[model samples]
Target: MTGRTGLEAVRIQHVLPYDPRQPGGVQTHTYALSRALSDVGHDSTIFAPSRPLRVSLGGTRADLALHPLDALALRRFLRLPHDLLHIQEPLLPAVGPLALLHPSPVPTVVTLHSAEVVAHRFYRWTAPLTRRLMRRADALICASPISHQTAVPAISYEPRIIYPCLDLAAFSAVTRNPEPNTILFVGRDEPRKGLTLLLRAIRQLPQAKLVIAGPVRHSTRQLADGRTTFLGPIPHEEIPLLMKSATCAAFPASGGEALGLVLIESMAAGVPLVASDIPGYRIATNNGDAALLSPPNDPDALAQNLLRLLDDAQLRERLANRGREAANRFDSHVIARQHLDLYQSLVPA
Candidate 1:
């Protein structure tokens, strides 16, 4: 049955390497894309291990850790009836490798979401196998140009660029009630996420009140003083409100970002942004036109950018307006239509 797009509805199975319940970009992308597809009358089902096994790398969770049993189960499930399969992070162990290597009857599309593919130990260790499995995909997509550049050398193929989708309406609906001199930061407690760097930056801005969302380590929690508030791991639905409450948002990721979805979310919420000037972030903010950018790992630069946004209301207004315009490009419905077109191209009429 055809829906609004005038194309037959397709059954799409999305395979995620990590637990969907976990708050992460891949999870959010899958959920948003699936919902958007469903809105246009497509059938979308998400599959992942009920409980993912965790591995720590440099004191942070390694998302690519192998789950052999889970991979085997996912491999078996791939045989089930489906019009198409959309696999995220196809090099990620166990779901990714097993799913990609599985001889499914349906067309498979794999999306590369990591910018640090060349540097990741797991990707390096399984390079040969990854190269082989990648060839089996019917189509390939990269979240951003940085991801494309990092993946092409390893996989030997250029993938079409497709930015991650977000629920722009929900974020746009948030009532803007910015608190004076308030800065909001949302990320997991990882070194790559640069929470420590943001903290150091906050030290330089004495009048800034920082609001942090997402999980935090005890040692890191100890660092928060009267000026900082930790609202650990809030529900995804509440992010819009949290974003709207701030005068501006900061994403100080040091490295290893494929696409900074938070940057897009901040833009959608019509909040001014101060983010690290990295490849992935640069793409998300349209070469830093939508936000103020600073050098990664430089606390002074980040602090200075944050202070500038706080002090200049006119600059904040201009960035927020530009951000909302940039964010419209990632609206879920628009991305869903692109996926629908890709699915149609793969499926026989």
Candidate 2:
């Protein structure tokens, strides 16, 4: 694939187990990276299920709709024409085993983005098969150090660390003045995400209003009073504006977060952060330098941190400015080149 000065333009296919129509970090990352590659003269396509709700993360939609794993679907995926096969979530039994059963005709790359706890539980039954498939990949990537640690024991080769990248310029160009006392919370209402704790914290700070931007699943706690408003699944394109309008972005995940993509968006938008002190959040925010760290599952600590950011103007500005500068390292162009270089390395020298 190497040319005189750089690698020649080639087609790449990304296989995803879930639908991109739903709002998710992995889907958003895959779509954004595909757009970045297109800007650099490379063609990228996604193979995922076609849900009724069609959505695009500011890029081309999935080229082909993948079906449930079976002999038919497996054969269909194997016949696609491409220079490389990129698997987003590598441990899914439905699609991952195909890479091992019949090795792809071209190079294959796998990216692992889950925490150790979740990955272990999901792959416990088919550990050996998953390990073998991971080993067979030409390149392995983990989005964070915690992800790398979680995936190392499954494969023989060391995985490269690549943080999830975003279009920082888009978020930076947004010039909307933030609304005071408006705290934005994104992501689904999972137990690990600490939405319950956030509600309790909000109760302590009666003056602040919390704007929830995602779907809530099985959250019986009703806090939709005058203090909370649920926007109900904001589009991927509008996330930058939502971030820019918030006084502070909160991701109070108690556990099981590999890399908080919302934290990156908050930083890129120059919005101060209030995240839980979990390993994934620590690695994502550089050990609390970029965000205000609160104890996991503690409403009092979360409330205190939120109040601190809301109370002090200098502290918010300082953290926001630092986060903006730190976000440049995870820009879309920088990460696209990294993947391009890795793809070129897999070919013969």
Best by lDDT: 1
Would you give me the overall lDDT of model 2? 0.77
122-152, model 2: which lDDT tens digit per residue? Answer: 4555668667767778888988887776665
Model 1 steric clash pairs: none
Tell me the deviation in Å of residue 145 in model 2: 1.6
lDDT (CA) for every model shown?
0.85, 0.77
Q: Pick the candidate with the highest TM-score.
A: 1
* Model 1 C-alpha lDDT per residue in residues 1-349, reported as the tens digit of each score: 8866688989899998877777878888889999999988888988877657876644557554266677667766776778999998887645776787777888999998877644455656667877787889999998888777767645767788888888788898877989999999998998789998888889998899999999999988777779999999988888998987899999999878887888898999999999999988888888899999999999999999999999999999999999999888888998888888889999877
Using Cα atoms with residue i matched to residue i, what is each candidate's TM-score against the true structure? 0.94, 0.89
